[model samples]
Target: MVVLATKLYVEGDARERSLDSLRSLVDNELGELDVEFELGVRHDDFPSVTIEGEDATVARNVLREEFGEIVPDLESGETYAGTLESWDEDGIVLDAGQDKGVRISTDELGLGQGSAIQIRERYGLVQHMPLRFVYGGDGDPSRLAEEEQDRLYDWTRGDGRLNVNSATRAEVRATLNRAGHAQDYVTVERIGLLEQSVICTEDTDPPGLLASVGEYLPAELRCVVP
Candidate 1:
């Protein structure tokens, strides 16, 4: 069994949809390997898959490479994927499943993103956005992965949108409708359980949409500006 570091924290119908999405993602990545697996969610909401049949080890490695392995310790030179849990002037804290939390200082953000808040705003680094990181040992500096940097760069290039957490796709859509802003966005893309990216229409300002409909959604919403 391999427990992935990412989380699935939605409830009700959203929970079912998220589980189905996860199963499809894993299956598409591992189906060719002839592995039989059972997927489940733990109490803490982390996704886990137990594999059986021939070539199970190969299947496990495939999953680990696609998602990240949950670990209790951080070692120098080790790479990890974690949720962006919180941030302050000092740095950002990643919920990497550590006893405390993994800390990434402002200076380590690199790529000319400036302070922590600036980095978050510049990249649309919404809370619970899964990000890859490399850890450096004591007195050494850790950094975000190049792939992560590239992904953020891509988000900043197109029609910017709002990324939201702690709400279902239906709820978000309904909130937009209720707020009389249904025509402001193009679509809502579900990236994880309780997480979505609202693609804005050409005339819609992502930040304006966020401000107008945010109060009704009851979730944390951040805009990605192009």
Candidate 2:
């Protein structure tokens, strides 16, 4: 069984829809492989895939590569994926499937000035958004992965963006279209299963777009102004 790094925190009808979407997504990723699989959510909300067949090994690797895996142990200096669990003036915590959350100090964030919360806002990081980090065991300080930092930095260099949580990529796209702002956005990038980033057009205002569609999406929205 391989636990997925992404999360599924929605409840009720939305949960069912998200699960259905996940099933479809899993099929899309492993349908070609000769493996039988079952999907289940852990007590902490991370989805796990159990596969068995002649191609199970390959299937496991495919799932791990596609949706980062949550391992049982952390190796010093190794990179792993975790979901944004909380943030504070001191630092940010990532739920890395361990008894204690992984903490990355504000200074180690290396995302420029301000508090951890400020950094989160600046990067438009939504709660439960999957992030990569390099583990520094034995009293060493952990920090965000370079690739992850680069990705967030690229968001600020683009034509602005509205980052959202608790909504699927398809749901976000439909909401934008329904609100008559289809032309305002370049695309809805899927940050995680439920976290999405709406890349705006050159003239579109991220905050304005968020206000227009915020009421429609029963989700958290944050704007990244360039």
Candidate 3:
């Protein structure tokens, strides 16, 4: 069994749809190998799959490559996907299913020039955002991937938008409607199982939209400015 780093935190019909989507995605990825598998979401929302049949080993490798692997423990010089759980004067804490939270020091951020809180604000690093990080033993060395950094940077250069975490696409859309801000965004893009990017209209302000509809949606909403 291999657990995927992606999460599915949506409930009700959205949760079912997300699960079905994951099931289909797994089937499509592993079907070519003729492997039998069972896919399900864990209590914490992480997806896991159990492979059977002769090609199980090969299938497992493919899944690991496509979806980041979830390990039982942290290892030095290894990369893992974790969710941003919280932040403090020390730094940011990532939850990767370990008994203790993994800490990413401010120096390791590599964002150049700023405290952890300032860096997070400049990059809109909302809680529960999925991030890829490499752990280096003592001296507290850990770093986010260059690709992840580039992606976050791009968001800052894009048109006014709101990136959301811990909600499904449908829920986000519904929240916008309920808050009377449905016309503010052009569309909702699903970045991960529970992560979404709300593309704001040309005249809409990302931060304003977040402030208006944020309370209605039980998720983290951050502004993206061009």
Q: Which candidate leads the pack in TM-score?
A: 2
Regions of candidate 3 where Cα sits further than 4 Å from its true position: 8-18, 24-33, 43-45, 53-58, 138-140, 174-187
Identify the runs in model 2 with alpha carbons over 4 angstroms from their true place: none
Worst 10 residues of 2 by lDDT: 17-26
Q: Deviation in angstroms for 49 in model 3? A: 1.2
lDDT of 1 at 71: 70
> Tens digits of per-residue lDDT for model 1 on 162-216?
9988775676777888888778888887655467788888898988998888777
Q: What is the C-alpha lDDT profile of model 2 across 43-84, one tens digit per residue?
A: 999999999999999999998888899999999999999999
The models' CA-based lDDT, in order, is 0.80, 0.93, 0.80
Whichever of 1 and 2 has more lDDT, that candidate is: 2
* Ranking of models by TM-score: 2, 1, 3
For candidate 3, give the lDDT. 0.80
TM-score of candidate 2 versus the correct structure, residues matched by position:
0.98
Residue pairs with clashing backbones, model 3 = none
Which number leads on lDDT? 2
Ranking by lDDT: 2, 1, 3
TM-score of each candidate structure, all chains considered together: 0.80, 0.98, 0.79
Where's the lowest-lDDT run of ten residues in candidate 1?
189-198
